[model samples]
Target: MTVLSVDDIRSRVDADFDRILDVLSKKIALASISAHGITGEHMKRSAEFVAAELAKVGIDAQVVQSHNPDGTPGAWEVIGSHIVDPNAPTVLLYAHHDVQPVPDKAAWDTDPFVATTIGDRLYGRGSADDGGGIAIHCGALHALGDALSVNIKVFIEGEEEMGSASFIPFIESHRDDFDSDVIIVADSGNWSAQIPSLTTSLRGNTGVDVTVRSLTHPVHSGQYGGPILDSNTLAAMLISSLYDENGDLAVPGIAADEPVGGLQQDVDEAGVRADAGVVDGYELAGTGSLAARLWTKPSLTVIGFDAHPVDGSFNVISPETRFRLSLRTAPSQRPEEAQAALADFLRARAPFGAEVEVEPTDNGMGWAMDPNAEATRDALEAMREAFGVEPINQGQGGSIPFIPELQRIFPSAQVLVTGPEDPKANAHSPNESISLYGLKHNIITEALLLAKLGK
Candidate 1:
C-alpha cells in the first residue's frame, strides 16, 4: 500500500485549520462542563456532534455507551472506526470532551464560554486542554480519509476531567470494541512553544480532607485567650507537618526518585513567584531540580482551608477547622496505598486531645509509557516530519487518572502522548488559549502519524 504524500495531506490539514477551530469553538460555547460529573448529558451532546461530523466525512462513527454498575450515566465514548481490512492493526485516538466548570467567570477577560481569539491564540475554557487536541485528531482523519490503510478508532470519553471512574470498567467489559495496537492520547502539551514534547509519565494523585475540632462552640477570645486549644491552630500545625523545611513531603509511603526523563526548559522562578502572587521573600518549597520536584517526586499541597476569619472571629477555641490536602505521587506509586499512607501519617501526627478526622477522596493511579516502543518512534518521526523538530520526552505533574487503566486493558498496546498546546497555554487558568500555529502543526502530525503507522 502506498502512503499518502506528506505535503498533500499537510496542505489539506492547513486548509481546514480555521474550520476545525470554528467547530471546536462552537462546541466549547455549549457549556458541556460536567455538573459535578454526575450526569453526562452535555458530554453526550458533544460526542454526538463529533460523531455526526465524522459521519459527514464518510467515517463510520457511533456512540458507545458505557454505563455505571448501577445503570447510571457513566461515560459516553465516541468511536469512529474506518477499517479497510480486518487483519490490519487498529490505532485508537483518544481525547475527552468533558471540561472542568468555569466557576470564576469574573476572573476571565472574555466570557468563559465564548471562544475569543486574541492575536494568534484562541481563548476559552477547554480550548487548549483537550478540545483543541480532539479537533486536530478529527481534522486529521477528515483529511486522510481513504488514504489511511490501518484501522482508525477514535475514542473520546466524557468523564476524563473527573476521575474517569467508569473508564476502566467500560474498557474491561468491552475490551474487543476498543482494542488497538497503538493509542494516541492528544491531551498533553509541549515543554515550551517551540520545543515539542511527548509526555512519558504522569504523577498519580490522592485527595484528603482533614477536620480538627476543639471546643463545641466559639468562646470569647479575651476570656479564653490563654491555654485555648484553637482548632485553627491545630489545623495549621497538622498542615505544616506535611512538609519539611526543605520542602520535601514529610509524609510516608509515597516514593520519590530523581527524574529519569529529560527535563523541560527551566522556568524563571521570580516570574513564577510574581505570577502566583507570592510575597517577595517567599520561595517555592523543595530544592534540586524544579522539574524533578514536580514530575518525579511526591508533593503535598493544601488546596483549601475552612476557618473563622478576623471579621467574624469571636477568636474562641473555634469549634472546628477543615482543610483539604492534595498529594501527588510518583508514577510507580499506587494511589490507594499512598492514600492510606497519607491518612496514617495525618492520624499519627495530629495534636493530642484534639479530634482529627481524615477522609480520602478521588484517588487515581498515574501512568508511564514505554518510550522506546515502535508506536512512539513512529509518532516521533511523524512529529519531526510535520514540525521540522524532533520531539522531547517529559513527565507531566498532573494526573490523567485513566491512562493507567487504558494501559492495563491493552497491555501490549503502545501509548503516545503528544499534542499541540504549549506550556504557556494557561490550561485550567484564566485566558486559556490554543495557538493556531501549533494546531496546524499537530493536525499534520496526526495525519502523518496515521500514514506512517499504516506503512
Candidate 2:
C-alpha cells in the first residue's frame, strides 16, 4: 500500500477544501436538533445525509437507530466502513451530526442555518461543534484517496447534543461494528486559531436536585414577610454555601487540590476571560491557575431552577423550591462519590432546617488520555507537521460522557481527540462557527496520522 506524502496530502486537501465546506454547509442547513419537542424526521434526514456523503467518498455507510433507555427507538447513528486491508490498523472516526437548537434567532448576526463566512470563521449552528468533525473525516478520506491504507470506520452520532442518552445501549448492541485500533474523536476545540492542541482530560459531571421546603402551601408575602422567609430565598442560601469568598467551590469531600493529569501547557488568564466572554470589573475565581480551576478542580453551577416567573405577579411565597446543581468533578474523580458528597452537604446545610432534600440526577465519569501513548506521539507529530508549530496539551472542563464508554468497550484501542473548534467558535451559542484555518489543518493532521497508522 502507498502512503500520501505530507506535501501531497496538503495539496489534495487544499484542492478539495471547497467541496468539504460545501458538504458542511448542507449539513448545517439540516437543523437536526436532537432535543425534546424536535421531530425525529429531521434526525433521519441528517443521518441519511451523513451516510450519503460518506458513500460519495467511497465508504460503505448505513444508518441505524439505537434503543433509548426505555427500550424505545432513539436517534439515528451513521456507521461507514472502508476496509483497505484486513491486516492494517483500523481507525474509527467519531463525530456527530446533531446540533443544538437555536434559542434566540435575533441574537445571531447571520442565519443560524446558513453557513456564513466572515474573516477566518464559517458560522452556523453545528459548524464547529460536530459538523466540522464530520467534515474532517470526510475531507481526510477524500484527500488520502487510494493512499489511505488503513481500514476506516466513520461513526457519526445523532444525539450527542442531547446528552447521548442511548450511547451505552447503542454501543453495546453494535460493539463488533465499532472495534478498531485507533479512535479519533473530533468533537473538541483547539487551543486557538494559530495553536493546535489535543484534549488530554475532561472533568466528570453530576447533578443534584436540591429542594427546600418552607411552607406546605403558598402564602402571601405581605402576611409572611416579617416572620418567615420563602423557600426560594432558602434555596439561594444553600446555593451560596457551595461557594467561598473567592468564588471557589467550598465543597468539603470533593475537589482535590491538584489536577491529576497535568498538561504540558496552561491557559493564559486573559485568554480565558476573553474566550469566556467575562464581563469587565470582575475578578477570576478559585485559588489556582486557570487550568487547574477549569480542568481539575470541582466546579458547581445552578443549571436549572423551578420557581415563579417575575413576569407574573408573585406576591405569594412558594412552599417549596427545587433547583438542579451541575457539579463538575476533577478529571480523576468518580462522579458517584461527588454526587454523594454534594447530596450530603446540601442535606446538612438546609438553612435553618428548612426540610431540604437532595436527589442525584444524570452523571458521567471524567476522562484522561494517555499522554505517552503511541497514538498520542503520532498525533503530536502530525499536528506539528501540519500546523508548523508545537501543539499544546490541554484539558477540557466539560465532560463527553460517551468517550469513556467508547474506551471501556474498546480498551485496547488508543483514542486521539482533535477538532476544528477554536476559542472563538462559540459552539451552541447564537453565532457558533469554526475557524477555516483550523479546519484545514485538522484535516491534514488526521490524514498524516492515518498515513502513519497505516505503516
Instruction: List per-prediction Cα lDDT, in the order shown.
Output: 0.80, 0.88
User: How big is the positional error of residue 252 in model 2, measured in Å on the Cα after superposition?
Assistant: 2.6
- Model 1 accuracy (lDDT, Cα): 0.80
Q: To one decimal, what is the Cα RMSD in angstroms of model 1 from the true structure?
A: 2.8
Candidate 2: segments with Cα more than 4 A from true spot: 36-39, 215-230, 257-261, 307-319
Decoy 1 TM-score against native: 0.89
TM-score of decoy 2: 0.92
Spell out the clash pairs found in candidate 2.
none
Q: Write the per-residue lDDT of candidate 2 for residues 321-440, one digit (tens) a residue.
A: 999999989878889998998899888898878999888888898888888888888998999999999888788888998988888888999988888788889898889999999999
lDDT of 1 at 434: 86
